[model samples]
Target: MKKYSYQKCTAIVLAFIMFFSLFAGVNQAKAEAGLNVNADGAILVDGETGKVLYEKNADSPLGIASMTKMMSEYLLLDAVKHGKVKWNQEYSVSELVYKISQPTSLSNVPLRRDGKYNVRELYEAMAIYSANGATIALAEVIAGSETNFVKMMNEKAKKLGLKNTKFVNSTGLNNKDYHGEQPQGTGADEENVMSPRDVATLAFHLINEYPDVLKTASTPMKVFREGTTDRIVMKNWNWMLPSLVYGYKGMDGLKTGTTDFAGYCFTGTATRDGKRFITVVQNAKDSSGKNDGYKARFGETKKMLDYAFSNYTKEELVAKHYQVKGHKTIPVIKGKEDKVKIYTKSAINMVIPNNEKDNYKPVLVLDKKKVNKNGEVTAPIKKGEKLGYLTIEPKNGDKVSFLTEEGQKKVQVDIIAVQDVEKANWFVLMMRSIGNFFGDVGHGISSTVKGWF
Candidate 1:
């Protein structure tokens, strides 16, 4: 009996251990399945159309760190394009800028107190290395002072329709990092802030307006002041670049940022098999909510890219010359033909989900000035004349939002006349009117005769 009791106790102990182990395994799996994004704010968008494919807390404003440089990059590119600033124009280092460059803890290409670097070199440093000193120098060169440059950055942000963005300083650094020399208009503790959506919008404009910026942005490693004692190999912080350790195919030209307040953030763009997408991940972390260095940001970006490339395909949602059912044709007054056909001026192509291929419908809107109360247009209407526009919407009646307010209203094509309608001759019009008058009189006489009978 004693031996049997001891054996039973051992068996029970083994069973209890097995049960807990199984429960722990299930919990681990649940945690892993929660969310691949692992970020405070994130978004994925169609590179060509600015369609919002996916988003999570995307509109919430947060610290942007070095990503603020993208706005600076845009303004600098504009300045160069307009010949307002020359690429080779030299910039003399200021005392404030010199002090910022001396910090070993900050990312920088050190500059001498009397250094005079050209615009192109400084820009390369800022873009590739996120160099703080180089960015300040470029800002000073463009606007004569950092204080003035911050104003330009904010103004440009507003003009671009970036609703949730504010620029406190040219660099994205915490103002206190400036050692009591922060931009005059900003508080000493303030930092630049932007929403994930705003960041994507800014990126969209940057790529569209100044595509040449990508040429420099794609460089993985470049030497600042090459062939000189001051030369330093400025490697891009964007680990997702094709030439980097976490190299992803088709990855190119973008920016990355990190700070104690912002954590890890990345704005990445990639093209594969002619399909391009833009992804933004802000404040990325591990399952435990701890910063996982550069890996966390790029890992989240990869998940977004995979989802976009795998699920979406470019499709012609509306074919050219497609006509609406009830609105296929409109009546014409005093014309050789009594009616004219109208159709879409061009095909409407969009990047849409594979499962939703047939979920869109066309909505036609006519120009009020072109059509009278009877929905008729007078004679002499030319072929291909614009009557109005046709917009596409989801058949399921789900409201779709885009990255920008303008983008939300852009899914439309022009409606045009299919053929010309010439005015009818005056003699023919007069004869037709005379015949119609007699017919009405004859019908009235017939009605009176029937009543008498």
Candidate 2:
């Protein structure tokens, strides 16, 4: 009887352990299935604020195919803006550009040495169709040669604060096959590489600096060199536009790329009810067994977009001239007034996930400290002088993090003085000294009494 009782207890304990293990497995599977993305790297960002909403291996440097053309496009437009080039200016096709236009290539607009194209035509082909040859032509026009153009690309990447990005060619092609004049200081082994985070940064700059690029990028199809019988019809390759299955309502201009080494990649932007978001996916599955030519890249993009739009909302967390609650009244000594009111230096707003918004808490961190010798804040403070910063975070028990405009994890803004405070007169100084003397005496008595307790 004793042996049977012991055996029954052992069986019960083993059954409980097995049940819990199965339950835990099911929950883990559910969580993974909800966010199962096939992309090697991905990121979703709030467009205006540059806040990263979601990311997976975003900072890992990887080959970015034709997405390199976005930077190339930026330089072209910037040159035009700076009067270095004109929109109608025509450029001759170089031997290298013609080679890039070979029919056997992945995608090309078929450039001919005999054909002279304007800057506008080249820019359109490069952006809308991901035309490699057209991109090389434009690069040559701007920097005199692709080698010099690549130097400019790297320089701009540095200016943009991209830590893990390097460009070997203006066109996003792999560098191993290039037999032409090599990029200065680069052995033909280098290929254009950028992290998904850097790619989103590049896109945000493109849209913010030159919003006009979107006008051309949003076009579904347009005829190049119209009215000519040999004019080529170019179609936009981005599938997230309104006409496709994964299409969202406000989807618009961006870029896409695919290569054997790079797999498939895309950077996309969309707006809904005045809120905009940017998303980037890199090195996604090249085939979903659908044989439709488009890989899992587009599907992964849709998943990210849907999650962002469905879960988040644009909120005005704080406003310009908005007085911070606890930090508004700052003690001031030797000043005309006893205290100075403070206000935010600028407006503060962000896209917060709807579920986390209720738990959101705004905190103001000031640089000033109260010194017993001087009493609170020293006077002669100028209005609009930067005192400190305001930061926003979620309340306790919340797992989500917010992002600042600079893409940092914490959202922070400047805290400025609302009014100027001049030094106090002699009479006012004497009154403050008397009050402080008595206040110290009373504090000593209270401390002595507490010690007795």
- Largest TM-score belongs to which candidate? 1
Summarize candidate 1's per-residue lDDT along 1-453 as a digit string, tens digits. Answer: 999999999999999999999999999897455446889999889887789888888889988899999999999999999999999999889998899998869988899999899999999999899999999999999999999999999999999888899999998999999988999978999989999999999998888788887888899999888899988988899888888989998988689988888889999999887778989888988768888879889889988898888888988888999999999999998899999999999988878887787899988988899989889988889999999889888999887777775565557789999999999999988987898899999999999999998
How would you encode candidate 2's per-residue C-alpha lDDT over 331-393 as one tens digit per residue? 887899989888887766678878555677778777755324433678888988877788777
User: What is the lDDT of every predicted structure here?
Assistant: 0.89, 0.81
User: Which residue runs does candidate 1 get wrong by more than 4 Å?
Assistant: 1-36, 405-410, 425-453
- TM-score for each of the candidates: 0.87, 0.81
Write down the TM-score for model 1.
Answer: 0.87
Pairs of colliding residues, candidate 2: 334-424
lDDT at position 267, candidate 2: 92
